[model samples]
Target: MGPHIKGKIKKTLSSLAGQSAQSLFPDLFQNESAKAESSTVIVPPPPDMNWLAHADFGEQQKRADSAPPALLALGGKPQQELIAQKLARMGYVVTTASSTAQALERLSANKYRLVFCGADAAFEEVLRFVNRLTTDQRRHIYFVLVGADLHTFYDLEALALSANLVINTRDLPSLELILIKGLRDYEQLFRPLLDILGSTP
Candidate 1:
């Protein structure tokens, strides 16, 4: 090709390359003023989960402090009266039920911290009810099984029965002392766990 023609062709090619570059990447050709006028992205901060947890814990603590702990005594009239008197002495608001159906109805109506079921009085059904409770609900209740044959304060028997304590019917006279001892042991075992979970009983 002639020198003049070659020079013209090269100039035309350079002009086309610059136009193609501008079309492919328009941002690259933007003026400094235009770039400065673009909007800035603003991100919202994350939610404060710790604050929510603390608020929930505070509300539970207030409710616990305001109410007397509730106790459900299920069995014969004589035994129920004895349990009621003994637990009331310890500041519990005791409710009595003569049968398993009555006991289940009471349980559904209110949240009881303590539950004493006579082993000879529909104990199996009550035990099943306790067993089927949610983990959160089960941990909050202190279940006691009272029977003529149960060994009082026997850890193995209590564990087998899924009860917090097992009390002999003969020891109903000492129900106060036995319940105090059982509560102390229960607190020692569960306080740390409840603290870790940030739950109140």
Candidate 2:
């Protein structure tokens, strides 16, 4: 099998093994014996393959999959830094920009799954940025506008803009839950294509 297919098979097997272990022994993950066994288990790569190509492809995939989302803090430095730290602790990578221009530059050069814009940013500027993205690009990204109050933010007609989500900065304590929901929604949106890919011969 090709390296891509091999990797997929390995992932599938690993997932199945995890599920089986969890069902058979509810505390398997928390057991010291299971942890020790897992630590010692290592599988060698298949022979007669281009190891370099496989390694490179794996590295590229890791970088792409684990890349951080971009954050436009504008004038909210302290708030943005706190949010970034929280997200990092939760296993999310975040890139913070001090200004809308800087955020736009980063967005132009990279593909981010999520983008958070601070309410301090001009509503018109945020709208323009969202409008610039193509329909397909917009589909892949969740644009969020964060503010102190949704009422004031939406009253400015910014609700008519192309943001996928609107978050109140006051609700920063629940930011993790919001992020989890957003990710789940995004996954559900693309699940059909993922199912087709997994089933392909």
User: Cα RMSD to native, each candidate?
Assistant: 19.7, 22.7
Q: Give lDDT tens digits, candidate 2, residues 24-118.
A: 67775568776777788554432322322333232222232344565554445567876776677555578877666777778788777767777
RMSD of 1: 19.7
- For model 1, the stretches where C-alpha displacement exceeds 4 angstroms are 1-67
lDDT of 1 by residue, 132-193 (tens): 99999999898998888887777777888899998877778767666665777788998999
Worst 10 residues of 2 by lDDT: 46-55
lDDT of 1 at 34: 81
Report RMSD for candidate 2: 22.7
Instruction: Give model 1's TM-score versus the native structure.
Output: 0.64
For each candidate, the alpha-carbon lDDT, in order, equals 0.74, 0.61
Pairs in steric clash, model 1: none
